[model samples]
Target: MIEKCSGNTLKEEFEDVFDDVLIDIGPLSVYYPPGCINRQVSEQSRKKKILRNNYLIKRNQLVLVRGASGSGKSTLLSLIKGIIPDSIFAVIEGRFQFVEPSANVFCVFQNPYSQLVCPTVKEDLVFTMENRGFSQRKMAERLTQFSNFFNLFHLLENKTSKISGGECQKIVLASSLAADPTVLLLDEPTAFLDKDARDEFYAYLAKLKGKYTIIIVDHHQEQILSLADQVIDLDVGIDIDLGKKREHTLVSENWGMIRGAIQENYCICIDKLSFSYAKDAKTQSNFCLKDLNLNIESGKIVTILGQNGSGKSTLLKLISGVLRPTAGNIVIKQGCHPLAPKEYCRHICYLMQNPESHFLFDSIAEEIEFNYRKRGDRSGNISEIFGYYFNVDIDVDVDLSRSPLLLSEGEKRRLTFLMAVLEEKGIMLYDEPTFGQDDASCKKIVTLMKKLREHNRLQIIITHDEKMAYSISDIVYRLCQGRLIDEC
Candidate 1:
C-alpha cells in the first residue's frame, strides 16, 4: 500500500485532481548530441534520435502515444521514467517536471518476460511492497485488495512461469498499482492480449481515470483511444495545424477479407503427441498437449487457438522440436518419407512467440545471414525482397550493422517473422505473430500469409488474436483442458 503523504504534502505536489496539469515538458527534445562510437545514423535509426518538442499533458488524463515501430514511442516513456540520460546514454534537450517523482510513478516494460520477478504471483506482487517497508499483514491486505480489483484473486497462488502472457501482464499491472502510484506508464500494455482480452482491459483502465495520471504507449490503441484525453505523436507533436487532429481515430488496417479459396493437401502430420515441462527448463511450457493427431496442409493456414494457460504455445513447441512430445510424434512430408521437426529443419522454420528466443547473432545483417545459412541456403536476394515487400512503417530501414536486440519491440517481431518467410520453407510455424505489431503492420503480415498460401506453402500460427485468426486461418484448432480439438 502507498504510504499516505501528509495532507500538506499532497496539496504541495499534486494539483486539484480536477484542474491541474500533472506533467509539464518545457521544450522536451532528445538527440544523440555527440557520441564517439556509431555517430553515423542510418535512415531508420535517424528518427530514434529526435523527439518533437513541447509535448504536454494534464492530470487524470490518459495520453496515448502512437508512431511506426521505431519512431521513439518507447524512448519517450524511457525519458519520463528517468531511464534516458540518467541510465541509458542520450542528450536531454528539455526538462520534465512531474507532479510526482519517479517513486510515485510506475513504468512497465514492453517485454513481459523481463518485467516480472519472483517465482509465484504472490511473491512477485509483494516484493515491491516489502522493499517499501510495508508490514507482512499490510502486504497481504493490499495484495488481496488489488487482486480482487484486477480480477486476479483466482491466480494469486499460481506459478508466475506457468501463467499465460496475458495473465503475466495482469500481474504486472496489479503489482504496479499496489505501489499506489500517482502516475502509471505502460509500454505496449496489451501486446499479449487478444481482441476480447484487450477490450476487457480497456474497461478496467477507464475506471481508473481520476485515480491515476495514466500514459500508455501502444500499437494497439483503437479501443483505448476513447479514454485518451491527449494523444501525442513522437514523430510529430500534437499539432492540429500540421494535419494531426485531436479528434482523429487511430484504426488498424483491416484485412478480414481473403481473395481466393484455399486448397488442402497434407504437408505435416502429428501422430499422438504429448509434452510436459522439465523444472526451470531453458524455456517455460507448463500446460500439456497430449495425444494430438493432427495434419497440416499446404495452401492453408492452421491456427492454434485457446485461452491462456491452455498449452497453445506448448503445442507449437512440440512441432518446432523445442519440446519433445511425451507420446506420439510430428512428421513433415512434402513428397518424401516423413521426417521429424529436428531432421527437417530445411523444410520448416519456427518463429517463437518471443522473437529474441531464437536470436544467435549480434547484428541485424548477421542475424539475417544466420537465418539463411542455418537453413543451408545461400540466397542473397532476401534483402532485396524484404525491402521491396517490407511495407511496415516501423523503421525497417535501420542500420543492418546494429544488433537485432536493439530494434524496437515491433521491429523485432517483423524481423523474426520475416526470417521464416524469406527462407520460403515448405512449412512455417509462427507463435503469436501479431504480438507487438500495430494495425497496418498486422495487415501486411496477413497479406504475406495470403501470398504464401497462393504459393502452396504451409503456414501455421499460434495466437490469441481472434481478428488475425479470422483473417488468415483456413482451419482453427482449440486447445481446451489439455485436449486439442479441431473446431473448423
Candidate 2:
C-alpha cells in the first residue's frame, strides 16, 4: 500500500515513518543546471526540465520507463537512486520520500565502465560486497552464484580492460545484484549483451521481479513490457523522425551496378591473422583470435556476429591497426603491402563500443566543429547536415552547447557515429553501432550506412543484433572461439 500526503504535510510525514514505504511522492518537478527559476524567461532555452508531476512507486513494483533519446529517463533513475541534487546538480521541487537511509537503492548505469573500479573481474565483482561490509563467506557464495548464472567463470581473473563490452556489462550486473539492494534501477542493462546472455539476464530478472522494487529504462520494449507491472512515459512533445527507414525502392536500381564496380577493388584484406593477449593479460589465455581470413571490398557493409568475448571486437581493432597481429598481415585498398598504423588510421574511422571514449570536447557543437577542422572539410555545415539526416531541429531536439557527456547513451552513439562517418574515410569500423538506439535512431544509422555504400566506403560492423545485421549488411559472418565459424 502507498502512503500519500500533499505539500508540507508530506514532508513532515517523511521525517517519521519513511522507511515503512518504498516510495511516496507528492507533486514533484526536476530542473537541470539548478536555479532555473531565477534565470530570465528568455533563458528558458538554456535550462532543461528533467521531470514533472511524478507519481508514487510502490514496493515490489516493476516499472518500465519509456521515452525518446535525451528524454530524461536516465535522469529519473539517478533521482530515484539518490545521486541527483548532489552528484548530478539538479533542482528539486515538491517532496519525494524514499525508504529511510537511502543506500538501499542500487543502479546499473547504461555505461558499465563508469561503475567499474577494480582492475580485474574477480575484484570488481566483490567490490560492492566489500563496501557494504558483507561477510567473506557470503561474498564468496554470492560470487559463485552470479558467476555461474552469467557464465563468467572464465573471466573471473581477467583484467577488465581486456574484456569485451558485453562481458563488462555482465560483470557490472552481477556485482550490483550481489550487493542485495532493496531497490534496483536499470538503464538499458541489456544493451551490450548478446542473445544468449541477454536471455539469461531476463530470466534472472524475471525471477527477481517481485523480490525487489525495479525500475527499468530500455528501448527493447517487446520483452521488457512483458515483465512490467506499470509503464511511465516521459513526454517531451518533440516528434523527431530520427528512425525513418530508407527508401529501398530508390536504391534498388543502382545498388547492383555500384557493387559490381566496387568489387573490382578490395578495400581491406586479412590473411591468416592472429592475436593474443596471453602473456600481458592474465585471462582468456588461449589467444583471442586465430588464423582469421576475411576480404571486404569497397561499397560493402559486412557485419560480424559473435557471442560475448568471441574476438569480434578484436578483429575490428586488428583491421584498424589498434592492435598488431601476431602472424599474417592486413592489406588495405588494393595495396600490395601492409600499411603502417598512422597511414592505416588516415583511411579509417573506428567507432568503439563505448562512445564516451570518442569525445575530446565538452559540448556537441564543439566536438562537431573539431571534427570538421581536423578533416579540413567545410563542404557542409554540420548543424544543417545533422538536421537533414535526423529530421530534427538541432536547437530543439538537442542542445548544441550542452556537454556531450550529458546526452543519453543512444544520443551519444548517434553523435559519435556522425563524427566518425562524416569525413571521407575509406573504411568505417563500428562496434555495436545500434546498441541503446530507438527504432528511429536505428533506422537512421542503417540509412546512413546505405548512403555511405553509394560512395564506395568499406564498412565492417560488429554487432549482437542479428536482425539489424541482416537488414543492413551485404554479408554476415559469425565468430566463435577465436575463429570464423560461419558466414551468410
Candidate 3:
C-alpha cells in the first residue's frame, strides 16, 4: 500500500531505498530575473517559481503525470532527475531515489529528432552501449534484438538524416530500451505517428507492462487510461490522485453544425499531387507521396490517417503550402487564394506536432503577445480571454520576461496553440495537437477546435487518435503507399 510521509522522514526513507544516491531538495523555490540594463539583479525582483510542495515519487510503479501546458511537469521531472540547478529553483521539500551512480534511468524526450545526434543508426545505438563497457558481441546482439523488436531493422544501415519522423522516433525508443533501464520516462513518444503506426507503437509498449517502471506523460487519454495504474492529476498545482476508470459516451452536441457549412464551401482542392525526396547515391530514390487528389472545405475538420512513412504529415504540408508538389497543382476556389510559403505563414497557421519548436518568446505571456503583435491585433480585454480559455489570471502589471523554453512540455503545447489562435488565420493545420496533455486538457482542446469552427475557420487536424478524428472531423481520409483514399 502507498503511504504519505513527512518531508524529513521521506528523505531518510528515499536515501535508504536508493542506498544514499537520493536527490534531496528542501523548500526549493526558483525565480527568473527581469531584463536588466547592464547590471546584476536582486533575488526579490526576480519572477518567483515553485515546482512542487513536499512531493514524493514512489519506487517502481507505472505512474502517469497529467497536467496542462506550462504547469511545471517537465521542471518536476528535471528536479527528480537532478538536472535542475539548486540556485535557480527552490525545492520546497522533496527527495528522489537513484539506486547507484550507474543506476538505470532512461528518458525519451518529446522530440525524437532532437535526440538523434549520431551519423548512422548503428553508430548511435552502439555508442551508448560501448560507453557502458558492454562487449562488442553483446552490444551487437542487443542492438539487433531492439531493432527487430521495434521494426527498425530496415533502417539500420541507413543514415540517421534520411529516416522519416516516425522511423526516427522508433530508433529513439529502441536506443532507450536497449539500455534496459529499470525506469523509463516517455514524453509523447507517439506524437508524430499516424493511426496504424501509433497503434503498433502502443502495442509494443503494452508488452512491457510489468517488466519495467514506466512513467509516461501523454495527451492521448482513451488509449492510455485503461493501461495506467495510477494517474497523478496536476490541473491545479501538485494534485496527485489514483486513476479511476469511467465509461465514456459520445457527446453528439459537441461537434455542432460547423461540418455542414464546410461541405458547401470548397476552400482547398488538390489535383493528382505527388512528391519525392532526393535519394543518396547509394540508395534508391523513394516517393513520399504519389497521385493524391483531395479537397478541403471551410468549417470542416478533415483528418488524414495512415501508418508511419505513409505521407500523412506530407499531405498536411502540401495543403498548408509549406511544400510544393512535384507533379500536381493545388487550386483554391474563388473565395480563397493559394499562398506562397511565407505568405502562408500569415494565412495558414501550422501547429507542429512538437510544440517546443513553436516557442519564440521568453515567457508564456510574452509568447501570446508576440503573436498578437505579429498579426497587428490587440486584445484590450486580455483578462477575459485568459479567464474563459486558460482559466488563469494574467498579472498585467507584472513583466513576463522568463524564457518559454523553461516551461513544462504541456505548457509549451498550450502556448503554441495560443500562438496559432492569435494569428487569426483563415485555415489552421494542427499536426497532433494533443501530444503531452491529460484527459481534461484533451477535452478542452476539442472544445477550442469547435469554437474555431463556429467562427467559420477551416481547421484540418492530422491525428493518430481515431476517436478524436471521428469525433471532430466532418470528413476522413486515409493515406496508403503514398496515395490518398477517401473514407466515406
TM-score of each: 0.79, 0.81, 0.77
Model 3 lowest lDDT segment of ten: 243-252
How do the candidates rank by lDDT, highest first?
2, 1, 3
lDDT tens readout by residue for model 2, 192-268: 88888888888888999988888998877888899998787765522223322222111122222222223334468
Q: Give the runs in model 3 whose Cα sits over 4 Å from its true position.
A: 1-60, 85-92, 97-102, 221-235, 238-266, 279-285, 336-346, 356-367, 370-392, 396-400
Candidate 1 overall lDDT versus native: 0.68
Query: What overall lDDT goes with each candidate model?
Result: 0.68, 0.73, 0.64
lDDT leader: 2
